[model samples]
Target: MSAARVPGYAELLTAADAPVLQVRGDWTLAHYRPLAEQVEGLRTRLGAGIRIDTEGLGALDTAGARLLHSLLGGERLAALAADAGALSGERRALLRAVAAAMETAVAEPAPPAGSAIGDVLEHVGIAMLTFRQHVVALAGFIGITLESGLRMLLQPRRWRPTALAANLERTALDAVPIVALLTFLVGAVVAFLGATVLANFGASIFTVDLVAYSFLREFGVLLTAIIVAGRTASAFTAQIGSMRANEEIDAIRVLGLDPIDLLVLPRVLALLLALPMLTFVAMVSGIVGGMLVCAVKLDISPVMFLSVVQNNVGLSHFLVGIAKAPIFAFLIAVIGCLEGFRVSGSAQSVGEHTTSAVVQSIFIVIVVDAVAALFCMEMEW
Candidate 1:
């Protein structure tokens, strides 16, 4: 650039203790190197405390700004004072604005503690809403199942025989031996206890009648139902839950198969068919166990024990036990299948619901039996 009239340089300004460096023009690479060297010399003596006076800069370019950046880091430049009044009109506006912003940033206040508490409350509200959604979904599922079951009563052709057979085998045949064995042991233990209590009353011979009537009337059916609930109810829930998790239930629906007919009705029908058969097996085995206890402990012959049981244990007691089997079967199948279908898209949910199905089935069975017993007592049969 040619020599031009420069501003802000006075002889008196150099006489002060502070150094005055003149900027030739709008900074160029050629002018920048000498200015940078001078700034470096000042930096060695003054560190970052050196002031950059942008006054009298004839013109400035990126080269000058870069040299200034090298002389003062952004933070140091923020702290440095600029001779705003002495600077060129544009440069004065830019420097003063940047310093003002830096000052505002440094003085900005932190948010209050109440704002943090509000954020926590917002998160808690969201969590509660999510929980409510899940509860509603579960309630809707139960309602749908019941509605579907009632509708199927008017159209029974949807229930396939083959599916019913499979469900029967799973819920009944597989469970028979276990149910029979448990009830047999229970009957034997009960008979032994009865004989021990009655011997003190001089009525040891009555153990055979006590064991037979109790087993045929109540313990046999109740024990079988409890066992099936633990075994078959849990199995049904797990099987259906697995189908749900693998999206098989959705596939069945897409293929025009009603999940209730294809999955639930079959299980219910099977359990209804299977439970009575299992209960019969349990009753027979339990009587046999009682006979064994009578022969060994009470010194009663097996024939005498059988005769006593036949004489005292009426057909009505056996009928009462058999009658409860169908109701118990229905509860076990329906609750188990319903819980299975209720499984969410998680393995933990499947397990939790499976356990709930077994527990709920057993609880319902006991409640029903209690009601039945109260009715029987009222009728005095």
Candidate 2:
């Protein structure tokens, strides 16, 4: 067992018709907790001609003096300070000071607590503000790019055809395998789902129509655009972010050449040119995959599938899908190049901006695609 603690205290005693309270132990801030607890009930004991004995007390501090003042009123404390041998000179001065200051101290009112609804509203407001900021930034960037593009149009010598070609190859031809493969797999999955569902209605042959319509109008361009957004957008951001990190963008500026023209324009133009072609390839690949599934599972031959697609699906659906390509392409390239320019010197910043580019591109593409789908439905095209 541990030894008992030496806590600060006050003990009362009665002698000669007078109550005596003896205060003892180290009454500094460190020991104030126990000291305060011990003296909690001592207030009721104070009566006429009460004697407070402080000579037995251990080390005393300002906190101790304040406790002493609280036990006895300021008058009694002042009286204690004035008395002979009651306290040391320094302690007496401290007690007198505490009594004087505590007399003038005013407590401020407490602040109101926050509520759940207020906190939720605050977060929503902040999100809306951030969204507005992003919209404004995107619009400004678009304007700057458009202005630069117009300048290049007026002056054809400034066009970086070589850079555009290189970016096109990277963003288009290099990406064909993944884009084609993913759409092909998705097409097969769609076909499987359609066949299983349509078979229940004794209309399994309509699976060909379903697959053709989906791939030609919606899935083809939408899937290709989404894939390119995730693939090409991130690449563009990383490339330009690297240049920014290495200060090559600065060097280009120092060399008196426009970074927008030399870097941004080429990537933007490349994506603008590449996405449509990729969309075409994706459409073909998806249809072929779906056709293969139809041939194997539904016993539908390639010739019949082609005939059904040609006779049933109009040229309008294909046109509707292809028309969205340039818009998706432009948005993805701008988002990517914009995020790349946003990158600071750090590798972490490059990575963060690259991720932002991909997310923004994909989000924008999906939203626009949805809106286009709605518009097309309303127009009956």
Best by lDDT: 2
lDDT of 1 by residue, 226-264 (tens): 999999899989999999999999999999988887888
Q: Which run of 10 residues does model 1 get worst, by summed lDDT?
A: 6-15
Instruction: Quickly count the clashes in candidate 2.
Output: 0
What candidate 1 gets wrong by more than 4 Å, as runs, is: 1-157
Query: What overall lDDT, based on C-alpha atoms, would model 1 receive against the true structure?
Result: 0.76
C-alpha lDDT score of every prediction, in listed order: 0.76, 0.88
lDDT of 2 by residue, 196-236 (tens): 99999999988888888898888999999989988999998
- Candidate 2 error regions (>4 Å): 1-112, 344-347
Task: Quote the RMSD, in angstroms, for model 1.
Answer: 12.1
Task: Note each model's CA RMSD in angstroms.
Answer: 12.1, 5.2
